[model samples]
Target: MTARPLWTSHEAQDATGGALVGPDWNANGVSIDSRSVAEGDLFVALRGPNFDGHAYVADALAKGAVAALVDTLPEFPAHNPSLIKVDETLAGLRALGIARREAVGATVIGLTGSVGKTTTKEMLATAFAALGATHASPGSLNNHWGVPLSLARMPHDVRYGVFEMGMNHAGEIADLTGMVRPHVALITTVAAAHIEFFGSVEAIADAKAEIFQGVEPGGTAVLPLDNPHYARLAAAARAAGVTRHITFGETAGADFLLKGVETGPEGLTVSAVAAGLPLTFHLNFFGKHQAVNALGALAAVHAAGGDIARAAAALEGLQPLKGRGGRRKIALAGGGELTLIDESYNASPAAVAAALGVLGAETPGTGGRRIAIIGDMLELGEQSAALHADLAGPAVANKIDTVHCCGPYAAYLWELLPAAMRGLRAPDSTVLARSLARELRAGDVVMVKGSLGSRMAKVVEVITSLASDGAA
Candidate 1:
């Protein structure tokens, strides 16, 4: 039996309003990167800031792509038989994604917040996996080109689609969410991330509330009840004509209330009541913040007319994502081991505090001290230094023993640390890695965190490299 196809040249041409220049062909999926293209995939030649995909169309074709969508015709037109030409490629891609979205008629969930957007999206995708084939935004593909690219790649047969909508400025989410037109919209939590652009937390909250602008008629709005801006968000949702709002968190009267949370290094035990239905589930992930992220997932599922119990059941096997919250044990040069919690993907004040809290609850193997290595949380504008310095109090409260700081902003945190607790401070992550390598030893529990621009993952690589490079 032949498998169902995602798109055909005729269908794609109709959807994108583009002209087919060659024989009809079918695509199993869509990809923008030639390096990532699989057999039978549609390769989209998109113009990017640094590189143009048109330069790689032949490369994509050579890689077994079923068809190529390009604004520019290839040099060897007479030789190519699977090319489609469009006025503009990116817009055509968006049109194709929208056409597929409309045709599938799947329940869509759009997630946005300062933090946990990707995590919650993944969790929701996992929950939706119980019902049928589910598709979600890959990684943190919550921005302009990423959203449409992800949408265009969605398999037409998927029962549910989850997309993460992110923005650094106002109006961005509005445009992306409008394309999504989600049946369920969720705000994980309004935070100070990208505050440099928004100016104030309230403004960030206001901007985040824009996700509700695209909620379909009779759709659901899921919000965090524990956030101080809950009322503001609720009002915004109502203004968008969304009557049913599901609030999740520890706050009283929350539609999805957390009754209790016990988070250890290995996993979490959570008891919650969602819409008056109580559920106690064990998740294979830790941290209070993670618990709330899971709650948002369940609330999103319930909002989409799915069973919360089945969604809750899916949480048991949740594994930590790399560069986000993965945990591992690295063998020391002199024997014994150390626990490493990798939060190296990105960082903000709230995220660091949550990571520290998770560290505080962990019992390091055999007489270990909790260590925290932090890099700059970028894009805070003028508040960068003050925000960095403010982390000292939380680090101390979490009982971090030795601390290392990297980047200019992180120096503020280094100075605020009590003299005795300060281990080292480096001008950049590269220098910080060298400084930390010398001091790391057996029986140490270390957590590394920084923003994406800070490139803190290099330190994680160096430390994990020690497992093989350093031994007794």
Candidate 2:
């Protein structure tokens, strides 16, 4: 079946106040990056401090872009390229997004937090898709430009739309939420993720609360009852004129309360009560944190007018995203298999602790040793060293047999580890990747994790390449 045209040239011109040149065309999608531009996509030539999309206009057109939205037209080789000339491309993108939101009657849910934003967003997208045609933000498209891009990409006929909004500074989310104007605003939890910018977790909570500022009148606010900042977020929601609230977690007063969790080789079996109804489901993912994220997702689904019981059942097929908690088994060169847990996408103190707890629950293969390869946790402010050192406690509690420390901050953790538990210490992931790959044996459970800047995924790539012929 052919997909419907997302934007016609006439509609785009009306939305952005831009003049069209050469020819009229219908776009099936929108794109900003020339490298990944698809056929029938309307490529927006965005300009930034470091790079300009105008430089790639010809390339984008050659790759089958229907039209290029630009502030300044670039010279093409031989072909006449279709162009929409706006005063500024970024403003043009935002205008298209606002127009799309006004046109669609989909239930919009805006989500944000210090952590679990991406995970919870994926969960919501998965659960909501089971009930209706749902459009969600791809990856971590929750920033200034990412929000508008995701919004503009939303289809006109979608029954539900979920957008993930993120921030490092205080006012970032407020600006985004104003553009989103969601019917349900969800704050996953408040933690010390970007404490370098905010100075304190309370300030982070206040910033996350900004999601409530743009909630449509009579909309709902879904919050985490387990977080210490719950009261602060709830108060801010009420102040923002959002009176309806749905709380989820293990706390006694939570509307979506978790009763118990049992872990098995397959995944986790969760028992909970949502809206006074008993519900039990299985999640093919690790950690108690994931179970909590599931509760929040189900609550948001119910708040958005979907059946909570059916959404809970949809969670049974949920799997961890790559670089999050994804697990893989690699066939070693000689004889056995090695289990690799990839947590290398990004990390904070709280996130690292949760990963460690998941590792603790795993029963390694016969004669297998539990190992952790850790890199630096960034944006921790002045407490960076202490926060890194604090991880040694979780490592010990989990009874990990070996610890490989990478990067300068991880050195603090290396110093605190018991001599018997120490494995390898390197200045960075590049240096650690070589030695760490050789040290692994068939019966080993290895977990790699760090912040994005730490480049820990490189280590995961190297270990994955060790698979023998015909190995999965």
Clash number for every model? Answer: 0, 0
Q: How would you encode candidate 1's per-residue C-alpha lDDT over 1-472 as one tens digit per residue? A: 9887989889999999888987899998899999989999999999988999999988888888988999998797557558889999999889987888888878999999998888888899898998778989888888888898888888878889999999999999999988898999999998889999988999999899999999999999999999999999999999999999988999899888998998755688999898898899988777888889999899999999899998889878768778888888897766888888899999888898889888877776677789999999998988999999999988899888988999999999999999988988899999888767778888888999999999999999888988855531
Question: In candidate 2, how many Å is residue 19 off?
Answer: 1.5
199-241: candidate 2 lDDT, tens digit per residue: 8999999999999999999999999999999999999999999
Q: What TM-score does structure 1 among the candidates reach?
A: 0.97
Candidate 1 to native Cα RMSD, angstroms: 1.5
Model 2 spans > 4 angstroms off: 1-3
Which RMSD values do the candidates have, in order? 1.5, 1.3
